[model samples]
Target: MNLERLKQEFNSKKKSILGALASGTDASPKGSVDKQIIPIMELLNSCPDAVTTSSCSGRVSVFLEGRKQSSTTSAPKQEHGADVAAAGGKGGDGRWLFVTHDHLSDDILQEGQDDAIFLDMVFGGIPSEPAAPRLLGQLSSETRYIHFKFEPMILHVLTETLDVANRLLTCAISSSFRESGIVSPLKNPVVAIRTMGLAFDSPVGVYDPERNMIQRFIEPSGLKLLARLTNDRFRENSIRIDSFYRNLLSTMEAPETPLESKQTRALRKKVEGINKGRGIAATRENRVEIQDPLEDGIPFLEDDM
Candidate 1:
């Protein structure tokens, strides 16, 4: 393959994307790119052998799960779309509820007054004693809080060579996002790296858009803390991601490779002589020492007999 030509093609497209981004015409989803992450993007795309396909720096969000969208409802729908949340578009498949890059708000939860019809329908017309306290109490088991997600940003990359792919994977795992980074499948032609971490799955609230009922059992202060903590974790992960890529670029460009063993060198030298056009890597003289692609990270193509 003409590797240099392929890289040139990648660069051309990369340039167009960057131009769009700088001119505020980037087609990438809102929230997918933030100013804080621009440095990492530029750092990666600047590499002669690497290109960033997509990336994010992570964010905090508040979401309420509503009943399945009815084909009949004419209300506007908000989505997982960050811009939707920002625009206060509350009707999506379910609204994104709330989203932010920084822990900018101390008030994340909205105060909800009790709903009479909901209490009667689900609680037999008996309000829990002392309406002043215990917002929804055990009715949380009935018409209650659901789950909210706390997610970190993720990034994907394409490297010009398999060796660079493997090295990037190694660097990612060695860094803080160990469980986060994953190598692409052998069939894939590109390398992908991402950041993954804990997400809270506890049911916090629920919404019945049809009934216009929303009941939250958690305190407003608690929600504020959750948002703050989410931002904290996201910022930390962002730093780690930046460091991982910087370290990868610097160390990879000028790697300190270990000296190969004499026996290993001789074996590779012998194998290099074989015509790789055949799946077999050895001749009759070296029949006992053919290398396997899976073991050595080499790709094995099917024979074209």
Candidate 2:
């Protein structure tokens, strides 16, 4: 299709999708945009050349993997509440044991408690333990693993053209979202801003159906460490998001300048140092200051774009 025709179609679709989202008729599993990511979403949607199709403002979750269904077997229905589905998982059978988009506090991690009780406090349920023989028998069956994941912010934006997508991708990568890229460039170009390096995922335990118990692979201390690291990543993710938004707005305002210039590279390095907690001092001429959105509050106006 011609570029103009494509832009027309893209804009039409974007309008419909945004309308649905605003009216709470969004077809996404969550049925609405994440509260934390609304500013960025609004910014992108306000731009005439781009619009966000989907996004997540990062999350910490404990997911229970369900048994794989065969061609003959139907998928199991989910019995959990809306929060479980909102966390995002494999399928209907797989559910989130615990999930939160907000940062976790260290107070949630208590020491000296029974592993089961501690897990119950964190995951909202306590699985019953069975006899040794029964446990052994259940271990031989299909293993259902529970995973703890710290997912970073991810956003998908559809742009009017590849140039617009590339500009957004540049801003994303400069903000330390190395995984950001133009996912679809030939048709309606789509830019995905994300970084797997900020994400954390580990198998924390396994479920025993025979015993109706969850066997934790890590101790209380280990879990505490994981929580601490996840929180650290959460803070970094917020910083990166704020940086990306600022960079994108600047790029939009000054589209003539190349985003890969030396100044941009120097700024990216400073942002990287901040993300790593290095506190590296920037040069006098090329300094770039970054603030934590979770701490100092969002610096940008909601309708800045």
Per-candidate alpha-carbon RMSD to the true structure: 12.0, 11.6
For each candidate, the alpha-carbon lDDT, in order, equals 0.49, 0.68
Off by over 4 Å in 1: 1-16, 28-32, 66-92, 105-146, 180-188, 252-305
TM-score of 1: 0.57
Q: How far off is residue 163 in model 2, in Å?
A: 1.0
Summarize candidate 2's per-residue lDDT along 115-216 as a digit string, tens digits: 565567555484633225444455532456778889999888888886666556657777888766565567778777777788878987777646667777
Candidate 1 structure quality by residue, lDDT tens digits, 42-102: 8767766666666656655555543343334345642333322222223234445455555
Query: Which ranges in model 2 have alpha carbons more than 4 Å from their true place?
Result: 69-89, 110-118, 128-141, 255-305
Error of 1 at 16 (Å): 4.3
Cα-based lDDT at residue 214, candidate 1: 50
lDDT of 1: 0.49
The alpha-carbon deviation from the true structure for residue 162 of candidate 1, after best TM-score superposition, in angstroms, is 2.2
